[model samples]
Target chain A: MTHALAAKGPTASRPKPAEFIAFAVLAALLAVAPFALYPFFLATALCFALFASAFNLLVGYAGLLSFGHALFFGGAAYIAAHVAKVWGWPPELTLLAATAFVGLLGLVAGALSIRRQGIYFSMITLALAQMGYFVALQVPFTHGEDGIQGVPRGKLFGLIPLGDDRVMYYFVLVVFLCGLLAIYRIVHSPFGSVLKAIRENEPRAISLGYSVDSYKLAAFGLSAALAGLAGGTKALVTQSATLTDMHWSMSGEVILMVLLGGMGTMTGPVIGAIFVVAIPEVLNRIGGPDFAQWMTVIQGAIFVICVLAFRRGLIGEIAARLRRTL
Target chain B: MIPLLGISTQALFGQLLLGLINGAFYAMLSLGLAVIFGMLNIVNFAHGALYMVGAFAAWFLLTYFHIGYWPALILAPLGVALFGMVIERTMLKRLAGLDHIYGLLLTFGLALIIQGVFQNQFGASGQPYPLPEQLKGGTNLGFMYLPTYRAWAVVFSLCVCLFTWFMIEKTRLGSVLRAATENPELTRAFGINVPRLITLTYGFGVGLAALAGVLAAPIYQVRPLMGADFIIVVFAVVVIGGMGSILGAIGAGFMLGIVEGLTKVFYPQAANIVVFVIMVAVLLVKPTGLFGKKL
Candidate 1:
């Protein structure tokens, strides 16, 4: 693990021009993607990218694997949709309310979850999240099966109305970018260094006088909050919150995204999220309805192959090969 | 209305009995998980899926082979254990040197594959498996009418759990197993085949889950999603109970089950979340879990 930590050092210290160029090109491509592809599909990818990046914050950087992140992501979506649809709040206020509400929920969840380490932590988070899932299922606010649908995407901050699909796409893009930058900043901060230290060697970090538990709790909260951001944004974009958002399968999907892209790399989760979401959609288009059901099988196969064969993931593998050469 | 603490005594007893039955399954599943975790240092995420397979096995036996519950109980576990052994030999064995997370991921993938295939074949609807003739009837227990099979399930699971506890705690083989868990390399150096022990331990753990599955099939509908749904709650029970002690897992499972059942009586809407709430509370007070040792 320490060796893996060292592998990240060179990339952390420098930001090359190529990285900026790549981001610019990706952003340009995304900006134009809505015109070519379905806006809904692009928005879905954006939401997942944010969600996966949020997940990456914990597993990739903090060495914590939470199997229950769907609770935060999907739970917040339900809440935001309910608020926007039922209460008739403007989109901006609904997003804020959803993020704050889910963040608080995450704080509570994180506080409970950080008590155990490693696999126990994963199980605990998963259990708690499942509890949330049941609540979503049975609760009246979720409308049982129908969920809170037809959520009005009102004016953003009482200005710049977001009724059009292209406008909504750009709104989601901005939010996703903000989330990505937040994660990037957090990973580069001194707090993140301590988190990396804890991940590498917990006892050593504890011996160095860092409060490891608190750091872990903080990371968990941040990850949950960001996932909430994604979920809240998604609710607005989709104009609905379904049971699918909070399901355990969704949690697994986010994990797949992070694992496929590159766990610790900043850009990896975004790429992975896009690929995971797009591949299924693309396959659906090509293979038709029967292929839609097989998407899970494909995802499962990908998970097995990725874990068994390419542990480094896309960006991580590239970085490893570059390090060996340089 | 006759009230025992503002509720009918018979109804209370019935709910308690139901709670005990649920606890029985929780105890069995978590117990297997503890055994596997103790020896293998990996949480068997597929325990629930294996449990589901146990139920399906019973369903298959009855439908295809005309085997009754009596034979299926024994056969289902054996079949699952055989499958478990095969899994150990092939995929799980290869993951021995990797991070523990990979074991979880591998089992998760296996679980998805298994559940997905079963769902594709059987669809999401549950298949009904009738109880055996002997255990089909009910027993009048003065206070409430008790279904014989439910009572049998609770008592039988209790016996199995205790028997396993006794095997692990009292027997010489148990000592060797404990020694293996403590220091596998040292035990291996002493000519004990630790790897083989690991495989057997996994098999036994999975068998325990299968046994629970068989027990549950007659009660809950034999469904593909049944195991997946209950496993998360079991994970919570495992956390609340603490993974270190076998007795703790059993005690916590039953305790939480009763609490959940009681919650259903008083506040029906909260029945599903009561166990999870208890888990959160337990985690807050004792992060190491009630019986877990700090690593």
Candidate 2:
């Protein structure tokens, strides 16, 4: 296990000029995506894109396969929805509040879980997330199974109304881009290098006088905050926050997106999220009544195929072939 | 109806019995997981799915071939074990010596496929498996009325768990299995067929899960998602116990089940999350798990 992990080395490499071009092209495509597609669908996909990026930050960059990340993602959604519907906060404030709360939640969860490594880490995080799910289920504000429904999109920054689908779509896109950019910068920064070092060889990092646990916890918190931002934005777009977001399966879905996108690559998560989010929507549109079943089976097949043959993921493979870092 | 801590003795004892039954399943499932993890170095995420398949196989046997519970108990696990061995041969074999997470992901995918297919076929509702004729009635044990099937399940699962522990810890083959787990290469150099050993171990572990499923079918509603719901809690049990020792898994399984049962009696709202809470506490205090050796 140690050798296999160390062999992965650091995929986070020095930034090249072509990477900028790819980023710009991605931004331009996303900016015009809503014009061609359904704005609601685009917004949802963008939310998932951000969610997957946040997940990749921990799994890809930090080498932490946190199986319970939905705690922050869905936990933030509930908080965002509650603040929006009950506290009547502005959209920005709601998102900020939820993101902050989940960031702290991540810190605590990370602190407890980082002591264990590998499969133990995954199981601990999963148990904690399942605990969070139970809290969401029993807590009164979540309104039990019905969830906090009809959440007001509210005005952005107290001035710009975001009720319209096109306006909300743009809001989500901006947030997605900012979140993705934040993740990209973090990946390239000195801290990200340290994280990669820790991932590659924890004992060696410790020998080098690095506080590996602190670094891991910091990365976990940051990843969690970004996931919360995505979740908060999703609540506003969808106009509800449900238990589905916090479910363990939601955690699995996010992991799937990151894996499908190419775990360590900058553009992979977004591409992966789009595939995952869009596949079900498309299936629902075209398939018969049993499509939901097929959707799960197909998702499972993708997981198996990705692990078996496409471990580098879509972007990772392309980058390898092109001999360039994506 | 003697009052104990402001609750009826009957209710308390009844919940305790239910907890014991839940603990029985947890013990069996986690025991299988520990054995497999020791041998495979891969967490079989498909465990719960295979357990569900075991129950379904029993259902199919009864519905199609008019087989009874006793035969299903023996045959279902055997069938599932064969399926598992084949999976190990064709799929899991390719992943040997790679990162363990890939095994987890692949098995997770298998689980989703199995669960999704069954759900599509059976819908979300549960199919009831009748209790065997002899185990239908209840015995009044003074404090509470105990269902005969539940008692049998607890006793039977405990026996199975202990027998597995005995097989892996006391027998000569068990020593070889442990040696392989400790160092596969060294054991292989000793002229043991380690790969075949691994395949059989996986099959045996999966068969244990199927046995649990058969035990649970009569008590629970035998729903498609039954294992899914139970697996997370069992994961909590594994974490709490640390999966290092077979006894730890069994002990923690029953203990947590009783704790959850007691919580239900005292504070019904917390019944669901209590095990998870204990898991967090355990992780915080002893990250290596109570019985786990230091990493």
The whole-model lDDT of each prediction reads: 0.87, 0.90
lDDT of 2 by residue, A200-317 (tens): 8889999877778889999999999999999999999999999999998899999999899898888999999999998887887888555755887888889989998989999999
Model 1: per-residue lDDT, tens digit, B100-197? Answer: 88888878877887888788788899999888888878978777888999899999999999999999999989999999999999999999999999
Runs off by more than 4 Å, candidate 2: A1-13
Interface RMSD of each: 1.2, 1.0
- DockQ versus reference, model 1: 0.66
The Cα RMSD across the true interface for model 2 is: 1.0
Top candidate by lDDT: 2
TM-score of 1: 0.95
TM-scores for chain B, listed for all candidates: 0.97, 0.98
